[model samples]
Target: MSATTSARSARLGLRATPEQETVLRRAAEVAHKSLTDFVLDAACRAAEQTLLDQRLFMVSGSQYQALLEMMDRPESENPGLTDLFSRRPAWAKE
Candidate 1:
């Protein structure tokens, strides 16, 4: 989507310590953005990074071939993946 589009916009409420608030305010001023714009941009960037980390993969040709080989292999008979298949705590899951 184009950066100017508001269709993807989401309002978020954040509580920061006074020092953090002051730092953000100063940064917004220096960046020539309104506080809302600065905060939104930062939030968007953080969200993008998080999504990319989970959904994207990068590798060299050899690594890619190794990954393909691993995918083609039959499932392991070991129990090592049991924990991975079970419910995981939020902090530990990802």
Candidate 2:
């Protein structure tokens, strides 16, 4: 379901130090959002970034050159892959 249309039925509980709570409260006030909203938004954003980081990587110049060389190589014949690609996808079939 789309974010705006989805019902928020889950409950979460967390503890924070007084100083942290004060800061979060002030920031939430400045952002014009409830404390729950501010925390949830920040947590979701951080979770997204963490997941994305898992799929992304940085390589040094030598590693990059190796990757480029691999891409430059000619495609090898793979009968299994070729067969898979030649068939109509299940969803596309009547």
Candidate 3:
């Protein structure tokens, strides 16, 4: 079934192991959402990320140059991102 149809349909069924079900329930409770809402939100985010990772991106020569220029630019002076990077765990360092 298409993603939209499957997502909207009320009668669709999914099976999970007891441990998996427990994890899902705990995640739902932590998010302060109903089980259905939690599962749907999580599933949609995962699906979108998977699709974005798998898709091949194509760009015109000008677009490619623009991207290259952006990448080559020095890091932002913004404190929030710099602070976030500076606080990375020791294990995160190469």
Candidate 4:
């Protein structure tokens, strides 16, 4: 279901100065949306962008080729990793 049509049970509250509220209300009016709708739409966009920043990345073509080449390399071991694996995990320790 679309977000607008979905059931909303959670409540979010925030504080803003009177000036801020006035600016927001004016912008919402200019945009032809209710203050609540305007704020919720903007907040959802910001949240989506923040999450996409974590999960998505961009690279140049040359950089992408370099990454592919690195992944194609034969597996090799490091002493540090070997030592780390030899130790007991923190959760397993007394």
lDDT of 1 by residue, 1-94 (tens): 1255467465568799999999999999999987877888888789889999999988899999999999999987767677667767678845
TM-score of 3: 0.49
- Which structure among the candidates has the greatest TM-score? 4
Instruction: Mark the 10 consecutive residues where model 4 has the least summed lDDT.
Output: 1-10
For candidate 1, list the clashing residue pairs, or say none. Answer: none
Candidate-wise lDDT, in order: 0.82, 0.88, 0.83, 0.88
Segments in model 1 whose C-alpha atoms lie over 4 Å from true places: 1-11, 71-94
Encode model 4's per-residue lDDT on 68-90: one tens digit a residue: 99999998989999999999998
Residue-level lDDT tens digits of model 3 in 1-94: 1245355756658999999999999999999987887888888789888898789787899999999999999977899878888896878756
lDDT of 2 by residue, 6-90 (tens): 6787888999999999999999999998888888889899998999899999899999999999999999999999999999998
Clashes of each: 0, 0, 0, 0
RMSD of each: 7.5, 7.8, 14.1, 2.3
TM-score of 2: 0.61
Clashes of 1: 0
